[model samples]
Target: MLFTTCIEHLRTQPIWFLLISSLGFFTILKKSATFLNWVFITFIRDPKDLKRYGSWAMVTGSTDGIGKAFAYQLAKKGLNLILVSRNSSKLKSVSKEFQAEFPDTQIKTIAFDFSSDILEGVKEIEEGIKGLEIGILINNVGVSYPSAAYFHEVDEQVWMDIVRVNLEGTTWVSRAVLPGMLQRKRGAIVNIGSGAAIVVPSHPLYTTYAATKSYIDQLSRCLHVEYKHCGIDVQCQVPLYVATKMASDIASIKRSSLFVPSPDDYAEAAIRHIGYEARCTPYWSHWVQWCFAGLLPEAILDSWRLSIGINRRQGKLLIP
Candidate 1:
């Protein structure tokens, strides 16, 4: 009887120990996912934090380029879309394209040109939205520098137009949508900014345009800090010469530093980066240049910028 008992104990010992070890391993693994999630994850840092949307998303300048890319990507992720554009026909075309691709999602178009003297139409857009949930708001539609010329030489109206569309439109849309987001305690704002916002080069066409982007950076930063505790995320998407109609002039589109990202790639990186990052420097080289700009003396920076090749031909911006 004693020998039989010893054999039984020996056989059960190994199996019992193995079972206990397996349970312990699984318990630790589960806790790790929970622990990491609880500690450092900020502003939808993981897939589990993703809040699904029921109602709407508004992207300004949605008919083309970065805005268009954001629309398609958001639609693919199952969000209902609102496409805004100055052209009804272009808006319709964009709406139709999305409708065909995402039969399951809702696509609406607002045909108001926010860039031209037609900003009087912004009020209509302000009243047009009704959302059960405004999950993602992308302030993307904006104008570019007209020509690489001096600041004073560029038409004053054009500069005003840039400020109106790029900065004011963003302000109005963000101000209009905040009530919904704050009430629900969930939403994301993606503001499209430029490298010029951080490193203002001396390009004639870029002067006023850079100022507009700087305003966007400041506004976005304030919103990010204000809403972070409330679970709302504000992000700025800055791309260095992303390939789109925006960069159609290939002759002058040299990458001063790194590889130029396609609009799609730029959108993907920007969309994935939610929350506070000083600015979304898409390329390492762009980031390096930006740091250099930050370190430069203001007078020196301005001097070098005006001296750069973009203005060497016709602009007497040298302020001699």
Candidate 2:
């Protein structure tokens, strides 16, 4: 009855009726399209055959967290693995674990610290992959603040380490691996990004960390455009929060939930998104968070994010 009355009143004002109807129709259409695209990409679209890019997939920071998960996923797909991390002992253990599970998959480990001597580390990677076909590169190594604090309250060395490991490290590694991909005219480079940079307006306490990830998102866009014709797919995968050591220590997310996925669970979704969009939050739950964040005003988001950081600094549990 209300709907019929509304239609009748609208019909009496033809101009108003047409204008409102057009707006409503477009809004619904746009939302429907977005929903369908999300469904297709999240569930229906098939993952690329990773072997087509090359035989070996190189992952940075691969001894633990998302990088380790990616290494395992790639190996399961029959791709040779090149695991890079700063700890040689952890690398050896991870390599042995992978070998035990995937005996047929070849594994190589590189112990190079991204926070120190990046040029030497890049050289090590270049030399290590010499004459080896590297089809995919997962630039997943990054650093963040131990906990939320004001930018000035943080030590200079801490922010410097974050920049070195997050920005410079990604840049140098991609430069080292790009030549090989260019020569082959086919490759995929997936940079693991964060929601702090892409989804929210401001991440106040973790300013340096957010800025570095913003760089990753921009670099991925430019690189994708630059090398798409050459058969190279560059993507920045933005994830909200994975139940990793970083989240445990820094974000204080002790348990995985609908919003915070386990590293392995996140990686399984992430692999399905490679070689598609230049930027994506591969996990469906993260995508939903991104959408909701988009609906709020920037000022609201800014205040909310700042409050969360402040609460954390005050020794309050924000997640639970």
Candidate 3:
């Protein structure tokens, strides 16, 4: 009876019914297309072989976290590595580990801290990669607050260090490596970005960190346009809550879950996303989070993020 009444109502308001039906149909179609595209990119698309961009890959902040994971993954693909990190001892240890595991793959270490002199670090990288064809550059060196705090509550030097390491570091390193890639006429540059910038509306307490990552997103998009015709791919891979030392120490995410993947698992997905989009959230679960986050109102997101930031400031466990 309800169905027949609804059909009669629709017939009575034919134009209104048709317009509503059309709108509903198109919305479903658009959503379906989006879902299919995500599926294809996440699962079906074959990743480009890393060697085709160049025989060597350089990863910044490679002593630990996602950068280290990328180093191992690239080495597994038989590419020589130029690992850049701040700690000489840790760099040497990681270098030796890589060499032992992948005896056939060459490994080099450059111990230049991005938090220090930017130009000197760039010079070090330039000198290290002098003769090698560095086909891939991973601008993954970044720093975040130890814990969330209001903008004024954070120490001056702390924020300065974050800007220096996140923004200046990425800019100088990309500048140092671009000449070689431009000369070769083929390369890939993947900048690791955070979901704090792209996924939510406003990250209140971690303002500087999110702002820097937003800058990375813009930089990657512009570079992608500028270099696509030159056969270079520039991408910003925005990932959410990977279970690394950084996440554990900073965000209090102690355990890896469906949404929070281990560094290796995140990097495995991240590697497959290069040379495709200008920006992407590569992990499937992260993508799902991104999708749902997109559906909420900006005001609601802002409020939610602020509450989380407050919790972090209070030393509450984010994922216990």
Candidate 4:
């Protein structure tokens, strides 16, 4: 009789009853196994399992920036390298440097430009890695707008280059490498993405660049779903800002900070997360930023992004 009376009383106060129930549900979720596993991976997980993907790791745009950093880190783990870049001289220089530092690890170079004929370059990549057991493919070759600009203001050539380098390069390179992964049934593909595509509520100024990057994110998700059962892992690594030549225009991004990491620092964290998260911010600080930013409504975030875009165009001081 008492239990029935208590239930009847709670039902009478619907709002309070619902609030209490919702709190209890959330509390349970906080302590669940799924939550604990997520916490473990987001905080403490390491890259000890990367070798299961294969023996050779190929990195595009590897002569400099994030691509170079990934190449060096993979070599540190004793993985052979296929370093692809636009500059053959730089490729030889970087390959020689890797050979000198990591004498035990084998290194190959493929000079290809993402802004040019991506199909020809992909054919070269396919021919170069023939008969080699490729375990990991880093689809890191990408180009951004020279500066933030309205869609109409961007030159036709610039638009083509952005799409060609970022979207076409990622697609064809992954296509060329995926068959090898399928044959082995054990490989990993890490496609470099930007927060402009995956994290931000809106990217106002760099329209085409963001669109290309968004394509990469979607490609990663679809491929991950399709290949996961076959022992292959596909991940899109979304990063906000790093101290790289491409991002050097903004004074704020010129120096490496905790939030804007150096290429090597970001890649070190990113490589550890290859097979773990389908879309990851990689840097812990960026994750914190994402959490805080998520609290705002999309309209507010989009408005703020618009303001930043305006400020950048007007040559005014703005926080990235």
**Residue-wise lDDT of candidate 3 within 73-164, one digit each (tens)?**
99999999999999999999999999999999999899998888999878888999999999999999999998899999999989999999
lDDT of 4 by residue, 1-320 (tens): 99999888878887977898889999888759654765677677766577777889999999999999999999998899999999999999999999999999999999898888877888899999999888999999888777778999999999999999999889998888888889988899999999888678779988898899999999999999999998889999998888898877632366788788899999888878888668888887887787678779999999988888878777775544
Better of 3 and 4 by TM-score: 3
Report, for every candidate in turn, its global Cα lDDT versus the true structure. Answer: 0.71, 0.94, 0.93, 0.87
Give the Å error, residue 167, model 3: 0.3
Encode model 1's per-residue lDDT on 37-124: one tens digit a residue: 5334323444322234235788888887888988887887778888888888998888888999899988878887776544466666
Ranking by lDDT: 2, 3, 4, 1
TM-score of each model, in listed order: 0.73, 0.96, 0.96, 0.90
Provide the lDDT at 207 for model 2: 97
Worst 10 contiguous positions by lDDT, candidate 3: 248-257
Comparing 2 and 4 by TM-score, which wins? 2
Residue pairs with colliding backbones in model 1 are 86-113, 149-204
Please write out the lDDT profile of model 2 over residues 1-320, one tens digit for every residue.
Answer: 99999888877887976998899999999999999999999999999999999999999999989999999999999999999999999999999999999999999999999989989888999999999999999999999998888989999989999999999999999999999999999999999999999999889999999999999999999999999999999999999999998998777889899889999999999999999999999999999999999999999999999999998888888775
For model 2, the stretches where C-alpha displacement exceeds 4 angstroms are 1-12
Model 4, position 102, has a per-residue lDDT of 96
Error of 2 at 230 (Å): 0.3
